[model samples]
Target: MSGTPDGQGLAPRTTPPSITQRHTALGIEGPGAPLADYRAAFQAARLAMAVVNRDGLVLDANPALGALLGTDPARLADRSAADLAGLREDPAQWAAYLAVLRGERPRMRCTRPLPPVAGAPRWAEISVERTADGRGVLLCLTDVTERADLQARLRHLEMHDPVTRLPNRSLFFERLAGALEQAGRARGGARIGLCYLDLDGFKAVNDTLGHRVGDRLLGAVAGRLTECAAPGGHLVARLGGDEFALLVEDSRGTDQLCELAERVLAALQRPFDLGGQRMSLSASIGLVERPAAETHATWLMQAADTTLYWAKADGRARWTLFDPERNAHRMTRQALSSTLRPALERGEFVLDYQPLVGLVDGVVHGVEALVRWQHPQFGRLSPNRFISLAEENGAIVPLGRWVLEAACRQGRRWQLAHPANPLVVSVNVAVRQVWDSDLVADVAAILARTGLPPRLLQLELTESAVMGSAGRPLEALQQLSDMGVAIAIDDFGTGYSNLAYLSRLPVSTLKLDGSFVRGFRAGEQPNPADQTIVEALVELAHRLGLTVTAECVESAEQADRLARIGCDTGQGWFYSRPVSADRVSALVGGYAPAPAVGSG
Candidate 1:
């Protein structure tokens, strides 16, 4: 022992040996032998281990513990475990550790972060178990930082899309479901919306420019979308292959959704430059906004998908809002379209003719043959209900052929019945029949097969159809006209008043559109402007050596005005609504022709 009172000490001061060394100094007796064996085992163990007294102080530690802490075993002794592990830096963590050491917890386990012993900070799973001998607590620490980091990376990859790094379909659906659940709790007035967008003509890019350029385009699009403003905690996701979706939670209303859609569309308007190629792109968006409580995620997505199809159909690069009523009507139209081909095969269609009377003498000069669908379910559907459908599905080619054959056959029947006065039959021709079909060949075949003279067959085309004609369409019309068939422009005055083309085409007559005819009523004063336009049109037709036919003359006043204006032929309810072939025969049989303005 050393003492410092006023002079020199009996022996120089020296640090005492550690507890384990002191235990070795004493002989291995009854209880001391087990303690000595435990000391040897603790020193030989590979994992980090420590013994902590009730005060949270480290009473002893092994070599592994010293290595884990980046300090020597002697330096670790008598230091608090919390201090060595760095938990004492946080007051709440320190308090929780103290509580576990006070016997308040049966067995405590936690993950603690330690200061940077290496370049990066480390993590350890620290577990405390009460010693069986009731001396103190034994601490066990396992390094799990690498595993935790790997798990985090795996989670990120699972939730995000690889191409755009946006939320994947699964994660988008998950967040959508969560938003719906939150909306359900709002009781009422909680609106949510979704904008489903598809890049228009995107496949053409991949086909012509290669998929790599397409991929670059998609990435540029994604970057722009991410930069777009998304209100109310909205999120954007890539739904695979040129499709993307935006989820707007707590949407204000349809106005907000529309605004978002507009913004999205506007974003795509800017041209994209990739691989030194400047390309312009547009998108079609389907917007669906509704009470989240009343709709599920699947239903909302379905509505958006259905509406997106509509947007594409109506013409790409537009937005379409979901309308239940409009959708129902479209469904009905689809059903009707599905049944049309079979109806044609079953011979469920019939021809109805309306007389074109001479305005000078009220005698039937010609008749217009209009197709009627004698649908078994719908009874009798007009061409208005199904003609556009046939055109859209490419069925118009076959359907138009059938009409031509039937009308020509009927014209032959009329010619045979009235050998003295044969009447011309005007058949409406669809734009698709003119452009997508071998119209000249079809008409020639029908005319020869039915043995009907070409001069007696008039094909009526809409003004817009004829006005837009060029290249193949113009050549086709010229061929048909050269075959002695009469070509007439129907629905005149409603479309491009292209007078220059009128003289250049093979057209022989102009059937002024019904809208203009309806303007000049029988008893009322005609609209001066309409009257002037009609007068000017009739004069123009005459100067061009083309007959002028006024359609939809509903009263004597209209007929007289039409006759006064030198319209050679007039047809409408005033003459009679569309009638059967027998009615046309009767009208033609009991009529007389007289000289009118240019009829002579």
Candidate 2:
């Protein structure tokens, strides 16, 4: 009485009267006692209702029931309910109807296509209830076609990325898991592949161009990726941001994945016209393939991400295959990066000094401070292994500050120990240390704390870093230089040179890149080109009033040539390799004449 009979698969609503209830409510316990009132009430009902005998034949019908079935009320009479509902053809469906007809099941409910009558084939939930008298069953039909359509529409929206209309990360993983399960149950092992791609320099697009343009670019990229994927029947999805993924089921092997990745890259190479502005972009892809049984969706994605990283790191716009060995190395590198801050706090980092020798006299004039990690497990580790990592994560600021303080402390100690001849300590400063941090403040604080004159501290930055600097970064450098902290462009001539701009900066020294110094061979005639370039560079520096320091002077001949070329100083293995503070004292000891190094 509370809900429509047999409402199991249908929404609940007030029940239509049972045949016996109809008779009783109409006050007609006997045949022919009938009722205009009973007919009117039944006809006015909103739900489609009917009465069916135990033989599954319709005994009576309301106007709503007649209209729903697309039959006249007279035509509905004595018609088999199973036939009218389109269930007579299927034995299983008919049997379900028979249960309620025989009073075995109090109610029966099902959603199915009714016999074609009018417009489209209408789908409905058919509910049947056995009468208390066990003579017939009452039926109510509810149309659910529109509801089903609404649900389908909602499901489509939920599983797709709004921007690109591609399967979102959620649906991608779901399909991947399902594919893996299918592959696991197959006789011949099926392989699956995932190609993870990220747009290179996407952030720059967002920063320089508006996000509206960035979004348009992403849409364009997604379209290209979709075209590449369509040929191979691969599924492409946007995994958020500028990252997208391709899922290839039953993949042949790495060759197929490689081809797909190459196609994707090629597709992206074409310039995009975003609102009439032409832009060229490239993507870095990570290709990973394996037996489906051997990997899950999560790990597959992880491996793909790792491979993609190497592709970007190896210089972007290319695809990199997943290599376990490379992954192991990355894991180690990640572990090291994680421990760097803690290592600094634990005093696990120490400075080693390599003398910046006077090339002409071979005298140890100054020491370039090299920071080394006295890693607990790995022993002494060189800066090459972790310096770039530090720069990437902005850890270089603190790490460089610590190195500056330590080097200055040593420089002060050297000045004290040998008042007649003091040593200058050149500490390498990362670009991030200059741009992202307060270098002037840090240097001033450390210089004052260590009692080391600012002139004794030479801050070395890469040629690229100095050349790229502008605005606040250049202003910060000027401030430090004004404070008497000497600024040297290390590895000069390695980057795009801007001598005109370089002359305007407060740069005090030019350290020739190791490549140029290595070009000067020992025990052989110096290459004329190398000599010309070095001489030219040295002359240019001298004209700018900047001292020239040649790096990587590995042989006496190389050193002699540099000094002869009027290079003011040199630092390399030809000098002492980076040594401890104790060794620094030993190297600088007993140098005659002026031992005192002055502030800038």
Candidate 3:
């Protein structure tokens, strides 16, 4: 009897026991006594068993062992037990078996694959233990082939998608993580690439043709994608809905990824015929490939998602590559949008005034109140960086109210300082301010708080926002105008250019867009078309009782050209760039006596 490593055994022996004594000590008894009972028990045992000497040579094997090996019991004698049990194929297990035979280890157990016998390969768990005499070892083998096959089937079902019969998102992510980790350990600049794809207008197909057809279309698309990716042996996965991803491990470079994307796009465009309901569809792909050492799974997927949006935005049936600079800009925009509401409360906003000088008199009559963000982390940012973002996120309502209140306060201060010639303060208003907020009440409240007359406060809106105003917006504009607040259309000629419709609305002034003003050349070869257009616009505005202002007047030459064309006021760098409040005050103080309101 062999003892386990835990210092326990069936029987203790001070000296080596004979075969009969060993059998009798194990409680085997019958009519034939020890040897006959031992032989009967060994042959009748269900588990395959063999006895080997210290040299690993099999001294004897039971009929059960012969049946497992597909051979005769006598033939197993004189054969190497390690070889018969397939332990010699694995060096570690062979070494462990040798250690057990040398009495260094009490026992050792391991699983190994057996060579084909009778055209049937088998896997078995083999156990080797030292005998009670410490002169030989007993080997036992157990078949586990069925268990291995069952586990493999379960793994396949777990990792694959049922619809497209491809890998699902779970397996895709697993493979991506593994590829990234392996690439990190690989040498020679190995990289990973991903093409994140989404079928364009796939929802419409489901809406009209039903989901069954949509599913079939998806299956066809998956087949095409697999065929396209087959050349590079990439992994194609269906990531829910119409979205799919192709993963390239050990990618060559951007060129390879781009080529694969182009191939996939071409393949998907060839009209998917789903049970005679033929339809043509396209896909947008976002491609990202980088050195695996520099990125991980989450960041890579995010980049791919963003790039896919770019592809759709740039028009579908195309692929866009990941751009770091663009990604940084988008990240900055998101950060600004998320922090905008809190930033207003933090007092990070301030106003800078640009002198809206009168083109005819060359006097500073008004100043446009431009808002600036004094961010703690990003420093100062101008309106172009965040105005639209604020509007989209609904932060503009509060931010706009703050700007109006602050500008009015400053306007009242200037009125007190220069009652003889008070400068009108102009502020830009986004369309959302009217629809999303109580513009009428907000303006009235700010006017009362700051004691700034509506006559000295002018509100500027883009032409597109004010042109087609109706419903609440139109009524709001009419009320603001009736309250004695001047309403001017900023960027006048850019949008809807409905000059004739201006007469039907309560508009007071037109601030020509910078593009039209930039067209006013000064040299010998001036742009005649631009000069004629500006002259006609100014004349028409004056006739309609609306003041005309020229924007982006950079040089004295351009200012002279605008003034000669009957433009009433000019706002540009020729007079001054947007400056601090203190700077605007100094300029106003140095000005000569002028009218209270020179022009719009």
Candidate 4:
């Protein structure tokens, strides 16, 4: 009667007759008529009207009822009311239908389902009345199930994710409270275990394939999740934007909880065959198994959320359980993030330069400018300690600008000191540092402020930072390269390895990851495996006309192997660890070492 019936499977409204219209519609010649006459009038009304005996047997049914029940009037009288109507399928539906019959004495309207007149289901509004004569009751049923069902469906849609069709935030909490009580009465359980999962890299798919495809992918994921819970009575819910939660019953220990987490991880390993895009993404699950000591759903959810943050922070596509030490780390992270904005304002960030030596020449050809924080309270903090926190809290944008300026200024300083043996300063760029901020403007500003020659500044970005760049990021990188600022893909081979896309990026160098470089020293002699990997990487870069710099070169033997394998430059303790600007400057100014060339 109030809201529009959304076009879901539901009933439509039946027009009720006005007082004067009711007399005309039903043709009631009332005045002093016996109650049987009044009962007969109700039974004869245009709407489907019926009266049933208390034992739930059909006593009377009218012509309109025949249309609703998919039967002729002659056959309708022979069938039981519940059988012909849809009440036979669901017991609850049948019970509600019977409550309207017998002694019920008033106008009541409801969209009760009925068997099809043709092949379609009938939604009917059933109203009943008690006669004064008390001989029998007269019932009125008008079909409005369509409108009612639509209303119910609309309510469901409001509280559920369309992709997952699962209970969302509001509905999840509502169900969780009930589950907690049932879990509270467990035979010998300690506490409940809640696993929260957020898919890593889902946004890139959304951006690349558009929201329509993204929604379909989410639906596919939801189907898999429902199957994941089919084995056990776990309650899985979608908490929006690729985040899902599972509430496991009778979960007591970390082992039990982790078992479910592993199932989730394995289930997701299957490819999502999302149309043509053979996308393979993974999730980070955070586990918090409640102890007997804990209380309340709020605290339980907080534990799950905290653990989930660690999963993403430690590394994505993995799971981490809540531990006391993890809590300490989280608190420390929050404290650090709180100060980042103010730190930028107070100029608390500084740059330290580590030399990137040419492995063949044994010369410091470039210095990677690394950001460090001299926190007022936390003492000195490395970027590893606080950079991720800064990125998560949106402080990376301004903080990154400061680092770019400081690194460029330092490179300009070293360039002025040694004009002949000029050096390039490489700076690590965070993913967030490029998403919203204008890379070209930021680099141009730094170069302008520091008066650093364009070649002196080398921007180092990770593979994840560049793989998804298409529009603005692509254009920005091109602008910076055109402006003479060199770009290098830092941490090569450690990200979404779309090799077909690598050559198209506007960059001049690739830094072989330290992991592969360190593998060289794993055996008694230079690891032939590591040596071979380096050679392959060097050849790839050489073919692309991009210089290769192998990282973490520690010994002369290692350096010799790298150079023989075609590595032109290397950065490690062998060249120098990240050092003070003054120390780096001195080394760059008067250093002389012959280029190491020749087959090993």
Q: After superposition, how far is residue 226 of candidate 2 from its true place, in Å?
A: 7.0
In candidate 2, which residue pairs get closer than 3 Å at backbone N, Cα or C atoms, i.e. clash? 420-595, 420-596, 421-595, 421-596, 422-595, 455-600
- The residue-level lDDT of candidate 4 at 493 comes to 80
Q: What is the C-alpha RMSD of each candidate to the true structure, in Å?
A: 11.5, 9.4, 5.8, 15.0
Model 1 RMSD in angstroms: 11.5
TM-score per candidate, chains pooled: 0.63, 0.64, 0.86, 0.51
| Candidate 1 Cα errors over 4 Å, as ranges | 1-152, 177-192, 197-231, 240-243, 249-285, 291-298, 306-320, 332-340, 374-380, 467-479, 500-504, 527-529, 591-600
Residue-level lDDT of model 4, residues 351-402, one tens digit each, is 8888887676567788888888998888989989988888899898888888
Give the alpha-carbon lDDT of every model: 0.84, 0.83, 0.86, 0.74
Report the Cα lDDT for residue 338, model 2.
93
Report how far residue 517 has shifted in candidate 4, in Å.
1.4
Writing each residue's lDDT as its tens digit, candidate 2 over 1-600 gives 221222223333355445666455424456775566667777899888987656565657888887887768756755567767776666777777777766677887888776555555567888888766676678888888787667767988998988889999999989999999998788468899999999999999999998989988898999999999998899999999999999999999999999999999899999999878999999999999999998888899889989998999999999999999989888878988999998999999998888887765656778899999999887889999899889887788889999999889989999999887788889999888877788888999998899999888899988888886889889998998989989999889889787886788899999998988887786677678878988998999999899999888777667767777889888877666778999779867553121123221
Ranking by TM-score: 3, 2, 1, 4
Better of 3 and 4 by lDDT: 3
